[model samples]
Target: MTTLFISDLHLSPNTQDITACFVQFMRNEAIHADALYVLGDLFEFWIGDEDRSEFALLIKNEFKTLVASGVPCFFTQGNRDFLVGQRFAKYTGVQLLGDETVIDIYGRKAVVLHGDTLCTQDTQYLEFRAKVHQPWLQWVFNKIPMFIKKKIVAKVQSGIRDEKEMKSLDIMDVTPSEVIRVMEAHQVDLMIHGHTHRPDVHTFEINNHPMTRIVLGDWYQQGSVLVVNDSNYDLQTRPFFNQSI
Candidate 1:
């Protein structure tokens, strides 16, 4: 069996390029895969069910297409798109996954996550995360009007950018110790995730053997995807139609 993983698309109403690419990906690449896992941030931001934008609906339809094709797909909450819930999942025919989920990918036990919780340094953001992800918060957010939600998204994005600018890159990224801790907790060597938008393979020693952390890149400058088959896993970065080097 083959499995595909992608995340951090940051999809929203205005990001036509990313939307186009994602639609193409689902129609072309995802159709044949045995399974698909969306780590998180598939949308730029999700306000709630009461105010889901047309873009979200479109993407949800795209996902439903994939699901109707008989391939299993799962979605985990990303920081931006954390508002995704049971309603959205049912509409898209996707199985909603928790923060950290362990599954067997082609024979190897792999741990998958959205990866933000591993960023142990951002204490303030962690607190916000806890609050926003609660069931009640989601219910309230969905009750707000679309215009109000858009304004909130703008405000939050501005604050998030400012916060990222103040924090060092190392601080925003996942900590090595945290990764090891999660690995130990999950009892898995191969972990795949996305959050920081840094695409690279991190190799470390575990039990006197080499372990790997595969980070999935966000779909902004280019398209990044990880494909795993029965034999091995491959990370491929593809340039968008008009993207330049």
Candidate 2:
């Protein structure tokens, strides 16, 4: 059986190509996998619960179909779309996974993340994360009306754009020290995540043993997927349908 992992689709009303690609991926490539792990950024913005969007309905249909077809789906929140919760999970037939969580992947211990925290250099974003992640704050925010939340989110997105404009690429990317720290803290050499949109499989030494960090690509010019079956793992990238990366 094979398990698949992907993230940073950043799906939105305007991202029709990515959405169409995703729909096909679920219908064909991902439908038969043993499990599908979406590590987050599934939407460019998810302002409210899953039940609110027809887009969610489109996504739910595919995921529910997958569950019915026997492939379980799992999710983790990213900086942009961490508000996904039980309501979305139930509607989509997927389980919401916690940040910095570990699981047995084909009998190997694998630690998964959305990868925003690894960008330790983005101090402002980190601070924002701290505030938004407070349980009390999240509860209060989730209770707000969708229209109000959308207004707030539009502001947040504008702020994010400004940050990207001002920050250097290195500042917005993962810090090597933080990656090592997380791997060591979790005691897992295999760390897989997506967020920075820089995809690669890097090997490094940790405690005198080989360690791997797999960065999943954001779906922009192309889509990437890592397939793991038993003791085998393969990272593949291709031009999206008729486009190039």
Candidate 3:
């Protein structure tokens, strides 16, 4: 059996085609996998678990169906969807994992994450990340009216888009030293994550020991999936049409 991994779908009402593609993937492919791991950014931005939007319902239903089929699903909070809470997990049946979690892949240990923490050079973004992740702050935000929360999220997303244009590519990408440090701390030579939107397999050495990092891609224009089995692993992209679902 194969274990499938994906990230950065950024599904939202505006991205119906991509959402349909994700639904099709859940029904056709994920149902047959031994397990599925979502590294994060599963949605454009998650306000809170109280979200009752049609789009959120559709995605949750897909996950519920996949999990009911006996394929375990795991999720890690992403930079965009860190507000995903227990209610979402309960409704979808996906186990929420920590930002960095270790798992066994066909007898080998591999660390999986959303990949934002690896970008240590992006100090400004990191500072923002730290503030938003505070439990007390999140609790306060969640208590506010849903409409106000939506406005805040919209403004933040807009700011992020503008900020990204000004930030250098190197600052946004993961730091090699941080990756090495994380891998060493976890005592795992293999790591899998998504956030930088650059999908590729990286191979390096740590004190002459071999190390590997696999980056998953965003699904803005196409779907990205990583398939792992006993023998090997492959990073693949699936293209879809823009027609109505």
Candidate 4:
């Protein structure tokens, strides 16, 4: 059996084409997988569990079906959807994992995370992350009225869009030193994460042992997936709407 990993779908109601692709993926590829790990950013934005959009409901129902089909599902919080709490977990039957969680896969140990924390060089965004990730702040945000919450989220998303335009590409990506440091601490042979939206399989050596880092891509123009079994690991992609890479 193969285990699957994906992230950065960034699904939203407006992106019906991508949503259809995701639905097809769940119904086809995922139904037969041994397990599925969503690194994070499954949705474009997730307001607390108390509030959900029509598309969000659709996605949740799909997850429910996927889990019922016998494939275990796991999720971690992302920069965009950190408010995925207990209610969402119950609705989809997905096991919520911490930002950095390690698990044994098929025989080898691997570390998985949403991958934003590695971008330590982005000082401003790091500061913002620290503030929003505080328990007190998250609780307060959740307590706000749904309408107010939407406005706040929209504003923040807009601000992020503008901010990204001003930042250099390197600053927005992971810091290599941080990646090695975190991997060393975990003592893992493989690391899987998605946040940079740059999909690739990278090889490195840590303590004289071979290590691999698999970066998952965003589901903007295409669908990206990593498949792993007892013997081999493969990265694959398909056109989202048939244009090109």
TM-score per model over all chains: 0.94, 0.93, 0.98, 0.96
Which segments of candidate 3 are over 4 A away from where they belong? Answer: none
Better of 2 and 3 by TM-score: 3
User: Model 1, which residues run further than 4 Å from truth?
Assistant: 242-245
On lDDT, the leading prediction is 3
State the lDDT of candidate 3 residue by residue for 139-208, as single tens digits: 9999999999999999999999999999999999999999998999999999999999999999989999
Candidate 1 accuracy as TM-score: 0.94
Evaluation by TM-score, superior candidate among 1 and 2: 1
State in Å the error of residue 46, model 4: 0.5
- Give candidate 3's error at residue 169 in angstroms: 0.3
lDDT (tens digit, per residue) of candidate 4 on 143-220: 899999989999999999999999999998999899999898998878999999999999988778898999998899
Question: Which digits, one per residue and each the tens of the lDDT, describe model 1 over residues 125-190?
Answer: 899899987888777877777788889889999999898889988888898889999998998989
Best by TM-score: 3
* Clash count in backbone of candidate 3: 0
Report per-prediction Cα RMSD to one decimal: 2.4, 2.5, 0.8, 2.4
